[model samples]
Target: MIEPTMELGGPTGPKHRPGTLQNVVFAVRGQAAELAFRDAVQG
Candidate 1:
């Protein structure tokens, strides 16, 4: 149940920008990887 969430600077600002979306994807992937590593270590 590890769900990664991204806040793209709220509604009405920069959320629809291509670069912003790319950044959000990268950020989410990084966070998910970090969480997975932690879970593997703990388990």
Candidate 2:
């Protein structure tokens, strides 16, 4: 996910541009972080 998103160079080509793909990346990472945190806490 991060690989492809980073490969696009982002939505604006060069400049900083927000897009749904970026959102998906953020959500995926966020969910992963949350799950890891929960596992750590429970363990």
lDDT of 2 by residue, 1-43 (tens): 2544343443443344455576666656766776787799999
TM-score per candidate, chains pooled: 0.53, 0.54
lDDT of 2: 0.58
In candidate 1, clashing pairs total 0
Q: Which 10 successive residues of model 2 have the least lDDT summed?
A: 1-10
Runs in model 2 with CA error above 4 Å? Answer: 1-19
List the global CA lDDT of all models. Answer: 0.59, 0.58
RMSD of each: 5.4, 7.1
- lDDT of candidate 1 over 1-43, digit per residue (tens): 6333334333433456756767666666767787788899999
